[model samples]
Target: MNRSFPPLFLFLLLIGCARNSEPTTVATETADDDWWKESIVYQIYPRSFQDTDGDGIGDLNGIIERLDYIESLGVTAVWLNPIYSSPNDDNGYDISDYRNIMTDFGTMADFDRMLAGMHERDIKLIMDVVVNHSSDEHEWFVQSKSSRDNPYRDYYHWWPAEKGDPPYRYSLFDAEGNAWKYDSTTDAYYLHYFSQKQPDLNWSNPKLRQEVYDIMTFWAEKGVDGFRLDAFQFAAKDTTYPEFPGLTDTTFIDYYAMQDGLHDYLREMNEQIFSKYGVMSVAEGAGRNFEDAHALVDADRQELNMAYAFDGVDVPKYGGYALTTMKEVFSRWDAEFAEDGWLSIFLSNHDQARMVSRWGNDSPEFRAPSTKLLNTFLLSMRGTPYAYYGDEIGMTNIDFDEIEDYQDIAARNGYTKARAQGKDMEQFMRELNFLSRDNGRTPMQWTEGPQAGFTTGTPWLPVNDNHAQINVAAQEDDPNSILNHFRQMTRLRQDHPVLVHGSYELLLPDHEELYAYTREWEGVRMLVVMNFSDEGVTVDLPELENAEVVIDNYESLSRTGSSADLNPWQAVILSL
Candidate 1:
């Protein structure tokens, strides 16, 4: 007979009408059920996903060619990194045009075909929207910088040169320079929280906001299901250009992003585009606290449906972040969003190191088990989960021996900053090898070949030398492979409603090497046990003594009475 476990937490996110300080009616197309609550998202970095044209760059056709592969993983939606026209300064984050596709990626027709292909396979397409900034080559930016009287001048944040250097501003990308870039022709400086080539748009301008709304509408009308807003926290800036207060607690210079009334802009955007289309939207919630996240994604706010808080992906620099940190992160969200809002769980992305390499043991002996352990936690969590490309095969980060082997602009800038600080070059390179975003940007390894079957021509970046041993081709036919394990885990999440809407409770919170949690929904309960270290651990749980072992990384569970001995880097899911 099946066992039942009583519910531990009874909470639900309150859904209310679209919000505005002024009087207005909300959109009518809201769904009765939140589809995102049960969906799995896969992030694809277009430049490295799959190259069909063999131009040494992945294109829309390439993604279309791989649609079946993506669907095979049981993912319901795809969050594509920027595919808009770009100068490639930041690998497509700097958009030159919002409405058209990059020439390298393909024509606008190709995008339509890709979208149709996905919809045909019941997959949703979520475009990457980079509204915080646009490429310097963008027509609007070009026109804005041409003359002071240009109508597009207010489209971007600009300060008169006669006023002297604008207040000390923070640049996340260019550490050594100010966030404002000086334009010679216009005799003014423009704000850019990132690279100079990418200038921040002026949200204070009503016209600029409308343009963004229109851009979003264009895509939504074209049948795109959602958007992943890139660097969205930095979208609104304090136009006043106030001096950054250098308080002891607030060490870094940040005069933008943390500004007040940012949500007002989000609400306006939702009213204008997002809500009208009834689509899912997620923001990149960097530098935001739990309270801030609640405000942005709370259903009552009529803003984004979800956002990615970087706590899980941006591991502490000094290292030694305990498994308790993960527990706190998710549990806190569970409470905060209990009445509203939603959070997204992810361990790897285009901007971070591989999951197994960063949070789990990447050694050959422990790689597969640790990879499954991380995936088990991710899929079992309450919120939507994101799987980065190449993570399924337990892909490990490459040790790009030198800086020359890297292609990410962030890595190059970091190297420059480290050298100027008098840091040891070799040590800095080693750190870069570990923490660099390029670690995730390497070409996807499809099969063992001259170029790892990624491209007939030379790849844009060097493929990992281990591709021969760990390519997808080798794992596709092996039922015990990590690829098959991911498929099974994904299918389990889809089949089990508890994994989607269950309340999470952390168990063994203080255990040094063991991370365990329980999920209870209605009267059904599930337990997930993970061993983070490369040491065997045996734990006894009376509730699970006769429980069924639904999922195990080792393909089988060793249970003796009420005690189960987990092998090194092992993980198991038991249903009671």
Candidate 2:
């Protein structure tokens, strides 16, 4: 299936024929009913969202109190990060008890109430299901590592010490990048693709796979609408431990991601749980390429509902990334899945740093416009858009000077590794400052008060200093504010079905400072042009000849017949 994609100018330049007033989805193949497809998913990093208790951590009750604020964003769903009982080694990702909520978060009753609250507001709740690994403290892991003859011993991958060494598997969060951690008690070395405290589960084992399914069904029956399978792409592994050649220089994800038997497990899980209760499933990654992505999703496979690919989000770097590069990646992905599979559109989440600081200009003067422009790009894209919580109000990164200031396990472990390997500590710190996951986990800014009104007590992480000027309460009344612009963008996307199910045609595909595109459905056509940089640029898209401004980030626009002069970080949606 070798295919090539020239730039798409269909709606903007070559609407050829099929121009009719009857509304329709661009692709011939689609689902009979698609709620998740039309959804605007707002990702909430619960630990930093709000804190009701004096424990300095966000809990279910805190989220319940803020339901109204979330509903006001016009979002259709909320994707909450893991709240399962954890050892806090890698935050809530290291699950100890899948059925119970973290004590810092609250009890099961609080979770029930939170789900009910979201449902009552007509907003769906997507729970994070971290099945790739479990905390060493998990009952199964504890029992499995207790003895070689334990009933749960097969639940995790273990190598007897007699075998000398388990093949070297890379660890993303280990202090010493070794995936095999020796256990004295069982005389075995267990595999952990992350922290030693977090052991990767044996997906090849049937009983262990059933355990994950049961846990998901437990939540689905409790009314969870969707599941974001965290790190699940790397769930399947070859128990024989085959050696990957030339792996030192290549990214481990190539060998680690989308292993052989992953699709079978997903298909079985879908038939056993998802098909039963109508749950939506989106795995963390789309694998390495189009074929891998399609195999995981493609609808006919009955595997996953959406491919939450990291290509777009992975575009930003400490040394800046190009607008053309982002456009190319996103446009290529959109074209790849234009017919069969679904994509999840997002730039920032719990795992990445602040969106404004990474993808947009977060400087005092340009923050609002840049953030709004980014939002415009997200909403106008042809995919299920995911908006990170603080992104709506333009949150910036809290670049820490020292590793001591970071709480992220990735950063702390990385710093330790840098020092141990005698690498360039200064450059490593620079990368850490710009790309630390802690930047996104900072406490949300609700008001200009003590702890930025996130909590009455001290926060789990220090609130960004910019919270005083950039907050929900400060921008609520200002229609031109970043927050309002986000709301406006959401509302516009909701009103125009074209924005959701339309064909996206890339205009000026080679532009370095701008991303201009058009979305057309039925006979309705819209041109969305955004200047992604801090430079005034006039775009000449003649498709906008008789265009009428529908909405814009700026209060006013300087436009002629077919061209418009965009101020730095300006964005506009024009109806042609």
Candidate 3:
């Protein structure tokens, strides 16, 4: 022992000490050094994307098999929906364990393989991180619920019944009463915002915060490039639990989960965990306003790199009214957070209906025109664009004949609520057909085969009947297919600086059926002209007199004139 340690050991010790003595470079840990901020992200709902085990559910291996296809689309990254161990209460939004891959999806080895394959293709992988709440079945939740005095009890939000106040009074519940459920074994009520099985996490506790931070670090160490924070705005709540002013007088309680200090916690998480891993953190603030959103992603705040803004894309369908007009919606987004922060522009996601059916036409005759128009508007906007799986092929929503055809909790709940409200069955069914998550969750249309080539057996959800006509195999051969158009759009965005990180100015602001905008960046100006109607229209383009046609939906476009005539549902990209 007195002979001294080996030279190799001493050398390693000296290197470690030198590393500790060196100054830590924060910029090296920030993903802003990468090009992810300007990249297009394609979202894949794993269970519905592909299946390799013939179990009717997608697995990591299935995604690995489709790496080439994903890369061929010209997308820079893929934001996978939750693939962690879960009971599927909210379709993987409720995590039982953060470190393990769901048995249904595949093993941890399969995940690593997929990550490696994506890396080889130069594609970034953004995992979905659901930290707002954990599944009731989670070990921490189970231990927390074991005893009121348990050391883990504070891991989740637990409350006692107020005097003379019903223990059942809670938010998010219908006639069933409180969202909190009493555990017989624990003899305490646990809070849940979405479902009884998903208990809200107590972020007020420092230990719980550290546990979450550790979990994020675990994944970061395992080579996760980034994360899409699920329902991130709901992470912090008002500790006082004060009742809304209207709650005493009316049944409507305007309870907002994103209270004060949420941004502080988010910024801390970014600085401590994500920043260290060089990961891109995107927050999902579904119902936040421009003020809150701007603060969350403002470069100076360093809370989030970007957030998913639902305001512009959630077109209401009440009274035969298409919520906000396209102009009003896009202009609001263009004016609000354009200068301060980045926006995640998306038309469809796992929670929403298929964009081709909801925003575009679903019929055979009008589908192509509407799909192209929608894509033109989305890609031309000044932000990062996210395309849902199967969107490139112009996929339509699945038409289920019965309630049993659906597996989504939200869809089933909506159907029951619709009928309980005495709504007309036909209208209710139509709404369900249009708005259900099943519409977007249907197995990806891969080919004309059993289960649409997504799985060997029956899919977890039924494949759309039109898969035979619109499958990826068929469209891949057609250069003018919707899938090819999407590739072209992405390529153009990559080639043109004005399309990404540019200033947007709306043209023809009052035009109902015409959506036109100019994107100017570093002296390069490009105009996007789109006709949202089915009839041809002539628009004055005096500002584009010297502009030449760069891209158009139709082959023939008039380039020599100041004012150009547009065909029915036509779009053109012009540049000077």
Candidate 4:
């Protein structure tokens, strides 16, 4: 029998008016005005979410079957990692076709079914659009490499190496190696900022830029709500190819991809194409800072509605192994993006380690509390929350004994590099196993059954070993389960508009063990307090005397006095 609670009726009542009422005023045309800013997005790594065809890979049909589960969480949108045709290098980041659904991920018909399902439930779908580069096997790249005189030759960045100077610098290679690779057929060097198999598109070529715009229009016309732009900052490179400083004896080319005119191009795309379709656009600027974040999302910028801000999430690996304190990371995030532009807050993704294993203690003894604590902290923050598959059930990282067991290219490359450096295989594998993307890429644990109920066959990536104990089926009936906590957190955000878009204020900023903040809008005030420590603590709450406890981690909250006493890893939301 299926089991799930429809969100409390009172919660629905609170948000119903706003959702059902027609707006009195029409806003100016801009990307920021897209419906996505008012949405709660759930990020799904397609290959790991679920499999309906028993092919061991999650496909569009599986997502269609799971729309009920997604809706239960109160999220209004889903951001799917690439499902386009690809060679699976970089796990679908290397797109070979901009318009086709990958065969492994099912046919175009399956994609239509998924979209129909989501739309039927009032949920929107956002697809990943990788424009920075395309797979070397792409038709354009193939033609470009076939002959120097091919019309497609200018579609990609190509430069001849100077007589005495070294080649352009590619970020993927080590020892200041050339970014360009010479093809015997074409006899010219092609640029690849990432893997050599992924050729960077020459945005300087108007034809290529227009082609990307056309691709966006094609998808938008097909009913997609919007796009999550992949590696958006790396779209354009310096045409002059100036050598960068800091590399010895090697001519390192500074790829000026995010230069001045980049905004103009983005503005044109937003105004001419995206605005017309009313599609939300979010760019993945992995290395951007506060200023860049504002520019990417500010209402007047007309570039993108928002971008993934990774400042706190990518904290330096602690002790070169474990994750650092959540206090340090979250405080920095609170200070960084607290001003104008919105943030896309997330704990784990298809490319990062599972939060439970990387940050929270994943052992049975500490797993429940740690998961609850992390969820409270993440959802209460001032931004759209993106929950990765299996995160709600506190999935742990995969433990693989052999290097051959890994599927992620980045992890395999790191392992190979470690082995070449003569590092101890056992120790290196242990660390790699912990930090690898494979940790987050494990198939979702749906139930305590064969293949964790994710697939009927062996999964493409291994399922977590503790699936039986931590599966969704085991937690569905428990109100205190992490899944239920996630439901409540999302419900609270939906019920209270202040929680979703209010100005955030960090209270007691120096408190090491407590992450306390207020979300105030108009005259409504809501305080979110989280205890990040392992021990019980007490803090005076004179400022919150008028506040009534609205939600608490535990059943009972101390309402006898002005101050609040918190148990270890406790969290509560109070409103005035």
Candidate number of the best lDDT:
2
lDDT of 2 by residue, 144-214 (tens): 99999999999999999998877888887887888889999988999998899999999999999998989
Tell me how candidate 1 scores on lDDT. Answer: 0.78
Give the whole-model CA lDDT for all candidates, comma-separated. Answer: 0.78, 0.85, 0.74, 0.72
In candidate 4, which residue pairs get closer than 3 Å at backbone N, Cα or C atoms, i.e. clash?
236-257
lDDT of 3 by residue, 1-576 (tens): 011100110000000000111111111121454466578899999999989999899988999999999999999999999998999887898899999999999999998899989999989899898887899999999899888888999999887544223233343322232556767675567777657888989888889988999999988998888888886676787766655432210122124445777877887899887778889888775334566666877788877878677655554342232312546676666666555677788887887778877776668876776787778777887777888998888898777778778787755655665577677988666666666777888889999987889998878878889988889998898887888888889899889867876677777767766778787776778889987666778888786698887878777665446887887668889886
Candidate 4 C-alpha lDDT tens digits along 1-576? 011111110000100000111111122222445456568888899999989889999988888888999898878899999999999888899999989999989999888888988999999998899988899989999999887789999999876444434344554532223466766675567887667778899888889888988998888888999788887776766767777544321112123335556677789889877789988788775333456566767768877877676545654252322122334455455445554455677777776788876555677876777787778767777667777878887888778888899887766766665677688988777667677778888898999899999999989998887998998899998998988988888888778877765666667656766778777775677888776656777878765687888777777666546687887667888997
Q: Tens-digit lDDT track for model 1 on 281-390?
A: 88875344656677788778788898677654543342345666555555555655544567798878887777788778788898889898989888887789999999
Top candidate on TM-score is: 2
Q: What is the Å distance of residue 369 in model 4 from its true position?
A: 2.4
The alpha-carbon lDDT assigned to residue 52 of candidate 3 equals: 94
Look at candidate 3 and tell me the lDDT of residue 278.
Answer: 81
User: What is candidate 3's CA lDDT for residue 361?
Assistant: 65
Runs with alpha carbons beyond 4 Å of true place in candidate 3: 1-34, 161-177, 245-254, 316-324, 419-422, 558-560
Better of 1 and 3 by lDDT: 1
